[model samples]
Target chain A: MNALDLDRQLCFALYSASRAMTASYKDLLAELGITYPQYLVMLVLWEEGSNDEGVTVKRLGERLQLDSGTLSPLLSRLESLSFVTRHRSAEDSRRVLVRATAEGAAAKERAECVPARIGERTNLDPASMPELLETLRALTRNLRAEPAPVESPDPPAAPLNSHRASALTARH
Target chain B: MNALDLDRQLCFALYSASRAMTASYKDLLAELGITYPQYLVMLVLWEEGSNDEGVTVKRLGERLQLDSGTLSPLLSRLESLSFVTRHRSAEDSRRVLVRATAEGAAAKERAECVPARIGERTNLDPASMPELLETLRALTRNLRAEPAPVESPDPPAAPLNSHRASALTARH
Candidate 1:
């Protein structure tokens, strides 16, 4: 098999499996009027247990490993649905804090069935879950620990066009 | 810890790791002017080895676990980049075939470094990779094997609203 065979790549395995997991959650999450990513936010708020202080956008970003650019739009959608409310911190106006609303908290009850439903559907062995979780977590941790790439001083060259195509194609 | 803790969910772990993997591929793929998903398609095409009769769109969709709705736009983007060409099959006008252009095949050279780059970035142990792949593949298999949800005749009820909110919150 080619070393670059798509099936042989760990990244491909993770990518395919991840999308499969998300697709499995789609209909169930639709019933709760949320997407999979939105469900994740609710889980965080639910875990915080109705705290008035809530979580800062920065903290949520840190937890989710997403930047403001991505998180802002998602948070806005949740706010528009009235599932979440965001307000400037009283003590620090510059900081925005997010909390689950009554509706959001109530949504949790519907969500509680999700894990069991997924479990039944996938028939994933419960005994294997802890180990699987640990492996995935380690992978994420290692990937995240990499140093950021240094910016290239030069602009990227134009994509290879047809002139060199025949030679390149011949080699493959 | 709450059973529903965001950090505790297997789906979240997979989702987070998947995004982390994609992010790791970004700079490298940018150099080749392709997105991660697009790169996956190329990998499949490259594996098929420059045959004149390329894979059909239906076959591509099955291999990628993506429906045509998603694949159509992605294929268009790859076509625009001159990496792949799509044409109606002469045998069946309805069937569209996708093949890597010479440029696409050449890209494999640059892509050869990707797995190693990702390996170094993640610092993933080579010994652990096979077991990890097996676990993830099983997860995907089980998830995809699930029966599609039965459509509910009735529209979902409005969010639980305030009446049920306090009870749900208290229980948590």
Candidate 2:
């Protein structure tokens, strides 16, 4: 296959599959009255166990790989929907904490069925699903691995083609 | 594995991998002076062959799975960058045609090397890459499969819980 072929690009395949997966979640989540991102937030909170102190905003952002600019608004929307509540942590007033609300927690019972439904929609063999997950996990790990810092002795105003490529490719 | 566990959910895996893939493309595409989405547009245009009559906006949307609302601004940005040119098709004025400019065509040579570089970053065995690609393609195909029209005899203002789940699960 040609390297530039859209159909052959693994990046495009991931992009398309990710979007399709999210789209498939739409109607399922609509019943629960939360968007997919909100559902993700709920997942984190639900995983936290009910008695634990809520997660700090920074922690949630780190977990989701989303910056505050994106997460702030999403957290706000989830708050408005009564799916989550936010408060300043007692230990650090500067830090905000987020946790799923009672309504949000109740929604989980319904939400539990979502993954299996989405799984059935994918029509993937149960045996092969773990392999697919492992591949995607490995890909993400490699992509997120930090590039070794470039030690440019004579800093150019702009990165040259070789510099840019090296910066992108240096990560294992 | 718990279906809702953040680390275990295949959707989360896909979502993270997709975002990470785009992040890795940032520096490579920055050298080309295009964002990742813009780079995707260029890929489609490049694949149309140098002399094709260009692609219609609607056709481009269908190809990219983006709606006019999203593609309009993206196409406009590409035009402003002089990488692409758009005009009303002569045969059908209602439809717009978009084609790569000479400058855009020139970028393809540079872009050709990107996939291999990304492949290196992924660190997956080249022999196993095709299987991964096939898996992602199958996942996307199954997710996008349209649900059969529901023949609901009882008309209800809101879909019941079971109805919603059936609507989502019936696609496969």
Best by TM-score: 2
Model 2: colliding residue pairs: none
Model 2 agreement with the true structure over A64-134: per-residue lDDT tens digits: 88889988999999999998899998888999989888898899899999898788677765655555676
Calculate each model's fnat, 2 decimals. Answer: 0.67, 0.71
- Deviation from native of the Cα of residue B90 in model 2, angstroms: 0.7
**What are the per-residue Cα lDDT tens digits for candidate 2 across B115-164?**
98788667665645555676677778777774322444542332212211
lDDT at A90, model 1: 91
- Give the number of the best model, judged by DockQ: 2
Top lDDT model: 2
Clashing pairs in 1: none
Candidate 2's displacement at residue A131, Å, is: 1.1
Candidate 2: Cα lDDT at B88: 97
- lDDT for each candidate structure: 0.77, 0.79
On the 0 to 100 scale, the lDDT of residue B150 in model 1 is 76
Tens digit per residue, CA lDDT, model 1, B92-143 = 9999999988899899998998888787666554655665676677667767
Regions more than 4 Å wrong, model 1: A148-172, B148-172
Q: Model 2: which docking level applies? A: acceptable
- TM-score of every model? 0.83, 0.85
